[model samples]
Target: MSRPFLKMNGLGNDFVVVEARSAPFRPSEAEARAIADRASGVGCDQIIGIEPSDRADAFMRIWNADGGEVSACGNATRCVGWLLLEASGRPSAAIETEAGLLQVARAEDAADGAKQVTVDMGVPGLDWRDIPLAEEMDTRGVELQVGPIDDPILHTPGCVSMGNPHVVFFVPDAEAAPVREVGPMIEHHLLFPERANVGFAQIKGRDRIRLRVWERGAGLTKACGTGACAALVAAARRGLTDRKATVEMDGGELVIEWRESDGHVLMTGPVAVEFTGTLKDRAA
Candidate 1:
């Protein structure tokens, strides 16, 4: 039997979304890899399965391109939220992910025809135990450095967890950061027990930052929703930026705010539907 899917993107981080509420669809590791393959499959950064939820509107299951299942995905959460809002004709919606329940609402549409949406991404985890480093270390700045001991290329990365662990290194120039050289090394570094997302952020202003991320299982991507959220929280914790900032990435920009009142993070961004199709050759 054939399965239908929706191709969606937040910023430039694209996904192949499968609605599994009526029929459950749990892809195996190899199957997820095949579905996310750029050459042979639907070609997306992640594959999202939307299953029925008793706690929320829907349950989101996320798999990275490398076929590793992850707990949280901020950008994908917004896309799914938009779908629910549009379908239910409601002002807000809730989505249950492995991370937690996220609240989403409609926002003003972008001028470029891309739909804008806002997602309440829950609170960021700031403690070392929350980020869950392999050993005790300051979450504000961990003692991990790349390159030579005397003159390290990158050092003292701030860590945060949006369900999944993330490490953010502050750099002078985000574009010039050696993302390709050292990103993969940090993702599998001994410090992170569950592996981690790596981010290089350059503070542009009190309310602006430029960032690039090497996602744990997806490698370098145009944008990462939780990556942006983590970057903002880390920056605010380090006194580099305000509680709110516009995170500019390779794909586009996301507005992230760490609410002082509730400690929850809110991300506003654009969602684009590229196309829709059916999977005729699903892997068993």
Candidate 2:
């Protein structure tokens, strides 16, 4: 059977979405790798599968191009939201994933009639066990040395787990942080057992922050919505900024608000439709 797919981007973090709600299929690591191949298969940073869920929302299965199955993906979630909205005609929707349940709503551009989306990125997790560090440490500001760059501009980082682990360092300049130089090192640091996404965040104002990220499975992506939310949570935990702020990335900007009433991080951004195609065998 020919499977339908959609190519979408959320602030430039692109994804290839496959709908498998009825005829459920789970791809193996090798299969996922082949499907995500830019040259051979469908090119995408991540491959998202939408399946039926026992919960109120649909289930989201996220896979990296490398074929690794991850618990969560923020940008991909937006892509799923867009797809669900198109199919159901509803303005808002709920999606389930291994990480947890997420509430998503439509964000329409009044001027151009383009569709943007907002995701309720559930509460950020603090504490050593939550961040799941190798050893118990202060998550508010953990020390990570970058070899010779001991006096490195980006030293201590505030860590948080938004389903996925992230380490955010407040830097003088987002561009100044050795993103390429130290991103890999910090990601593979001994302290982080599951590895981590590294981020350098520069506070532009009380309500704005600029950031750069080196994702865990994927390298330097244009944008990482969860990373942005994590950055905001880290910043708030350190008293550097308020709960609600705007995070600017290479692709664009997302408005993030760590709701004080419930602690759920709300991420608002734009989602674009590049095109759609049908693949033979669908799951083959």
Minimum summed lDDT over a 10-residue window in model 2 is located at 145-154
Model 1, span 7-65: residue lDDT tens: 99998899999999999888889999998999999899999999999999999999999
lDDT of every model, 2 decimals: 0.93, 0.87
RMSD (CA, Å), candidate 1 to true, equals 1.0
Highest-scoring model, lDDT:
1
lDDT of 2 by residue, 20-135 (tens): 88887677888778777779887778888889998945899998878889998898898898778878899999999888999899885635565788999898899889888999
lDDT of 2 at 87: 80
Model 1 score (lDDT): 0.93
Superposed model 2: Cα runs more than 4 Å off: 108-113, 280-283
Backbone clash pairs in model 2 (N, Cα, C under 3 Å; residues 3+ apart or in different chains), count: 0
User: How does residue 165 of candidate 2 score in lDDT?
Assistant: 93
